[model samples]
Target: MNRRSLIKAAGKAGAGALAVTALGGAMARAASTEPRAASAKPRIHVGSDPGIGRWSHAKSTSHEAGWTDQFQGMCTDGTYWYAVSNEGDNQRLHKLTLDFSSTVASLSAPRGSDHIGAPTFDPQRRQIYVPIEGPEPELIWKVSTGLSTVGIVPLAGRTPGSPAPQRWKCPWIALNPSDGLVYSSVFGDPERNDLDKYVDRVWAYDRDTGLLKKEIRLPSKVYAVQGGTFGNGGRNLYLASDYEEAGNERKHVYAYDFSAARDGSAVRSWGKVAIPDADDEVECVVFAHLTWRNARDTHITVGILDDGVFSGSTDNVYFRHLAVPSPGLI
Candidate 1:
């Protein structure tokens, strides 16, 4: 199966059953199987302002699939969103550079079609870490400028009934410059059990030990998980989906405020970032978003995901400017 099929399968499956508890696909099962330990702490606030305000999708003369969390990708400057797509017919990381308008650029991954599911940039090293799914031989490729292959790591096995590597693939990646650690989310196969859920957990990989240091579970499993810095040398990880929480029918952004989760640690439900209302419904949908930052601060450009005059699904990539409060506004 391909990425599109994986998403469609998720919608037809436990998606309905999750309406009661508000979780879907592999993530829902992971949440129920491993309940969160009580967070004695108060609800932490990760940002002074949090909301996507009025961003309509922007049609890039060059790219499509704007501002979506569906891919294992991150925004570069908080000014533009980019992704590595191995989706059917589409291959390569879709790059958009947004200024007054958006322009698309293509950077082919070192490997073939094994869809690029996760990507995080190490600005210091000028390197990009991307996870692969469904390639002839499964592996994750570390590509740098000139798209050099700096390192190659074999990923864990896929889940059974996992929808053929596309419908329900696992995404694992986390890099915080300040923490000096990488966190990866891993899952079991999708076909082995009748139950739809999977074992989803985050692990800290120490560069030296080569052994995962800490294993921490989340309040729930998040299919489109991405982590980055929020300006203060603190790590801000956000998970999104129109349907990704248990006991809550509404879509939500699970913000893990790990300003303090260094030294092999974990953070919890710090806050929620709301998904903007789409005129149409989206499913099993994995999307890549663009980013821009004045400096250390990072946020998506407005309307990069909104459908426009483009019509039909073609509207997936477009951006319209909206009034959003920022620290500058504060």
Candidate 2:
């Protein structure tokens, strides 16, 4: 769809910041229809404190710092976490120890890598796949473990010579180690910032061939998917939303059966968890069992695009232990 058409679609859908205000009752009703495990209870709680492991970027306005956090993307290799930020002048990748206690290294994206979105890491291939978003956003820049640009992967839906009407922005990418396939969320409202009007879908692509295999249409309630990841060895898929209800700032996270999605079936909402926090613009989430020796003791680490326009603090990263669901339920 063209930019004009996209704006018209959003208007027809009544998607705007004001429209979200009325979604509370609608969202609750939508949640009630979701099928859940017989024994599933609310996984994430608010009053309790977050996880034990924590990290901070320490609000920095210095030009050399690149950017504190601008729609950041993150993934971990059990020991180190790779964070990618879209700094207008100097896009950078920061590798930090899992504990968020120390910076292992910092690398800059090659020139013209403008507006890099969230990325997925391939441990087997030792590569990081980053989505480059711009006026024409379809390229997935491949960076080696040594932080070198190996090549670029064009999105199947928006190939180089294709019409721009059908083009989509890849906001986040996730790798399923079980099948070694890459998954990404694509959607946009064109000129409008109203996420509700955007057409949303989840796509699965072959990492090696860059071939598009399947596309799953997301539910309307899911306005924007900012980040995603596979859990339980690719048995389940988790996606986090971008926009939230103004007052509460509680963004919903959806879980889907990855196996079903891989087989070309409509992703069923296995369950949903809400993250209640002060940050209204929750960008992405990745689950890693960094602390415990047992793999089952996994926890979720959330990233916030701290613009300092909303919340004063520029700390963009957070760890939520209580937000993690029971292993038995996932």
Candidate 3:
């Protein structure tokens, strides 16, 4: 059976029931098979400013069909939003309306590439930068707005004089319009001993040639980074983490200042924004200029994969729109 059929069958087989619990001020949903410990709490590292401010729960939309299940990451072209999903051998990219009210188009993963992660849009090229993992070496694929593959940038072996082939499991990527560079981070726990020493650093690549430009060392160890986007005229990078443990809630979006690192100064104090849903896995975050009620406004959009409702008939993907004082233009 296909992935969607399998999800539906599993849902019918009682995988949809979720146990809800209140932990502190947030809520947690425990699956029927695996229960969470009552003592579990999210790990919070809120900077003094916490720049994003309180995210107002705006609106959420769920996709139940075959092509759009298990959303991994998302980006916007100012007018429309593009999302990527991976299901076993089936990986697809979907185009949706700005509000995510409906799907406009869907395309399968490019040949020879399997798992697709978060994607970013390039306004100059009018293309989407998709992070594809597997098929030996990972790649950053440049795709057209119509969902067609236009170019490919091999991520491995880009680091000069590397002792071995660098296998960067790029789960998320973002575009810096000001400098015309694409940024990506290694997936999973960067602090883990088994991971490469450089995994903790964010890699920036030239947009046109795809050559390794430079690596930015993070001020702190960020674990399980799933998605990231640029804001404040590409001066600040916002990253989302999906690290969750029995006693630690690592589902947070962090912001780092790029300008602070340029002058050999301390990378400035970081900012943090917590994802309210304790049960859902945080996916991707993007900044978009959206039109609501014929009014244009900028918003910080976050994608959450609601595992808590996987077994139920409800939609599993939640597109959360957050209101920030000034999201800054890209």
Candidate 4:
């Protein structure tokens, strides 16, 4: 089926529900074992925190003109922005203007991988770290700013004592400049009763070698994390969750203190901002300093893929530029 018909069919079934259905099988098999009770309750609460400041929407731009496949993750290098789209045999990585007004260039997904997830940019190495989901033993591809594949890091079979041999499914990745490590985790379902069992910790990899460095356990689990990036000058890690509970009209972007996690201290959410879109699927989040035309400022941008399947609209994608009092200026 073509894009339009596929979207129409998906719409009738419900876009969010369709995504869960399409991705659910892999997630279930990826779980090492059945959910069991935790030894102790997490220190942090499951819901939003009041201390976190709210992000106000500043502006948005559509990608309808230069439409790719379903938008996945996005990041920036203080100047241009980079994004990825996954369409199973036709995935792509896109370079865009700071405002996301137009696509500057595009590259086909590296050979051997079809589904590309959230991506992070490394300024020192000048490469974009992209998460690849399928064809088993998920991998992370390092592509240069010029859009050429530089290196490939296989994630599976690296961690010791991991129950399953092929469980690493990279849905998103983020780079921490301070420690020079890239972070990623297996996707989880927020609505599942045993959500904590699946997404209890995040794996950090050596930035250059892609070797398994360490696993940082969270004080609380954040389910269905579609995207992640380091914000506040690499002091905090921000995550975006796409799963919206039944009858709930909002999803959330969560924040965690990176320094505290490194110190092995009790880390809780600094705050969360609710994205009020019920129809569109939230894909990824990135913090960057952007300057376009006469406007110059910083933003905590979230990528919202138009689920024409749910919204009954054309295939489109856009980024919502959100503002906070202080964004740590990238």
Candidate 5:
């Protein structure tokens, strides 16, 4: 069976039966099937401002059958939201209302584009920035907020003195308004499963010239960065790992001190919290001031593209609404 079908079968086989404790902790499972020591009790991180804010299971919403595809990244423009997905026949950039009540529009990725990352909105220009895995040198596309393609710019550089062949896929992006620089997470060797070969390296680029400004190697533990967004009024940066399976290590959303990373320092690992759902893989995370209309109340929301438990059903996008303390955003 194809991977999606297998995923459905895995869910029906008991994945859906997995439940969260009242405290939002998922039952721990071993990363491999071979017998091993008893897994330690899962650590439940709590508190309003414990680095990564304490998260609670809010709710989940499913997508339609035709919408069954890989969800990569997401972002909102206060008034509307955009999510990027690719694979199968569902490759497109989706535009939705803030509440996901409806899809306002959709745009097919440029021909030759293989994958698209979560989109970043350029409020000053009224456009959305989307990165893609494509052609010889990958490119970032500038699409109008209305979901129309405006133009594309070739990503102009790579990590220096690396022995690995240059193969680029820009899967996450954030526009730091404080300095007009674009930070992106790039992956190498798309076909390799060895995590180290394709691990993520974040780069800051001059928005006006698209020239590489600085790059920092992420900690070796961050296997891949699925999506990211600016937080703390654009002072801090957050990156999310796309999901690993239940038996594997926990998926995390990590926060970083932006200024340090920009100054050629190691991307300091600030704080992180495990996403609550054990069965699903979190495709990406987008934080926006979606509640209370206050900067302090910005909430973190993640898109689960592959977690499902029901039988005879195709998995749709499942959004887990997370509640982080308002004081934490500041």
Candidate 6:
């Protein structure tokens, strides 16, 4: 639990900048310790992430196409930036502008549950909440990402259709930009092995009163979810790592205080936060959604997208910048 900076990449980060590299003291406390440590812990030399205080970016140089891969579920409309590409069979859904270009609406998923996890954007209810993952009865669409704005209306009572068999897993998207309230977590299928299936759901809705308002029921099964702002003023909800094996799982990150939920389905926790995989700690590990950049109200950035595949990692997907060694707190 001792970390100020931690991001790593063994080698080959797609070959395009963001090479991040740094490790301070005791090798940044033994690269974040955890290799089942029977002993020996100091080597330090994590990866990327260096400037958010102490860990900005190592030598990686921020390239690897600036970290872009099938990466699904991500939102930002401050001026541009939106994702839902996990690319896997070519699944698409796009919007970008922070210089990434390519806009005019992407959306390309007609089957396979269309994946695309927790993505939000409401700017006064202009609407743009994508929650696709079909296989069962789990489906959320809500469109008009932009172009609609009257007395204030958009996305009402599921009708975009397409529902049946979606066992939503790894889904994450939390937004409370004042009263947007869209926290979600109903996850399962960490990477995929299917252990009979056991995942407790977590939810909260009210983009404008589709009204479902938090309904958490957990014993486990929750890989990622983030939302926090104003420090202690009015928001903070994060929970990741719910345990799973083989198929990959285990990272652990928790923090709740959504006003202590008075009915949105009880959620009150002011502790437990983990994501330090010093070593051997890589099994469907989760931490790729914590973006609240610049200086908007405060600081809250936590994103980890290392598509560098691993096992030898070198298919490409690195460059979220580099050098992120530390107490393993991804």
Best by TM-score: 4
Model 1: runs farther than 4 Å from truth?
Answer: 1-4, 7-74, 77-81, 100-105, 110-113, 135-138, 155-169, 186-200, 206-211, 220-232, 244-249, 262-266, 278-315, 318-330
* lDDT over C-alpha atoms for residue 14 of model 4: 9
Error of 2 at 307 (Å): 1.5
How far off is residue 12 in model 2, in Å?
19
lDDT of 4 by residue, 1-330 (tens): 222233234321101101100000110000121212223222332232323355666555556644335767676664456777665466788887644557888888877664577788776687888877555556778888888888887764354433222254566777776677787776665433442224667777765555677667776766666778775435567777776644555677777766656523455667677765524777777665333332323256677776454443445776665656543322
- Compared with the true structure, what per-residue lDDT tens digits does model 6 show for residues 1-330? 000011012110010000001111111011221112112222322221212223333211111332145443345544444555544466555665533424555656456643445355555554556555434444445555552222211222233322212223325544554455654543443433452133344555555544455465543444323211111112444443323333434344444555445443554454443333312111121122222222111112233444445443322322122222232332
Give all candidates' CA lDDT scores. 0.37, 0.51, 0.57, 0.58, 0.54, 0.35
Worst 10 residues of 2 by lDDT: 15-24
* 1 or 2, greater by lDDT: 2
Give stretches of model 5 more than 4 Å off. 1-50, 53-56, 65-68, 158-166, 187-200, 243-248, 292-298, 307-314, 327-330
User: Backbone clashes in each candidate structure, one number apiece?
Assistant: 42, 1, 5, 1, 2, 53
Model 1 agreement with the true structure over 28-110: per-residue lDDT tens digits: 01111221222222233444233333222332212244323223333342333345444345556555443313436656655
Q: What would the TM-score be for candidate 1 when compared with the true structure?
A: 0.56
- Greater-lDDT candidate between 4 and 6: 4
Q: Lowest summed lDDT over 10 consecutive residues: which window, candidate 5?
A: 12-21
Model 2 root mean square deviation, Cα atoms = 11.7
Model 2 shows how many backbone clashes? 1
> 166-259 in candidate 3: lDDT tens per residue?
3535667788765777777665443345553223567777765666676677777766666887764466677776666335554677777675
- Per-residue lDDT for 94-116 in model 5, tens only? 88754555778888988876556
RMSD of each: 12.2, 11.7, 11.5, 12.2, 11.8, 20.1
Model 6, residue 325: displacement in angstroms? 42
List the candidate 3 regions with Cα displacement exceeding 4 Å.
Answer: 1-50, 53-63, 156-166, 190-192, 196-199, 245-250, 263-266, 290-298, 307-315
Query: Which of candidates 3 and 5 is the stronger one according to TM-score?
Result: 3
lDDT of 6 at 310: 42
Score every model by TM-score. 0.56, 0.68, 0.73, 0.74, 0.71, 0.25
**Per TM-score, what order, best first?**
4, 3, 5, 2, 1, 6
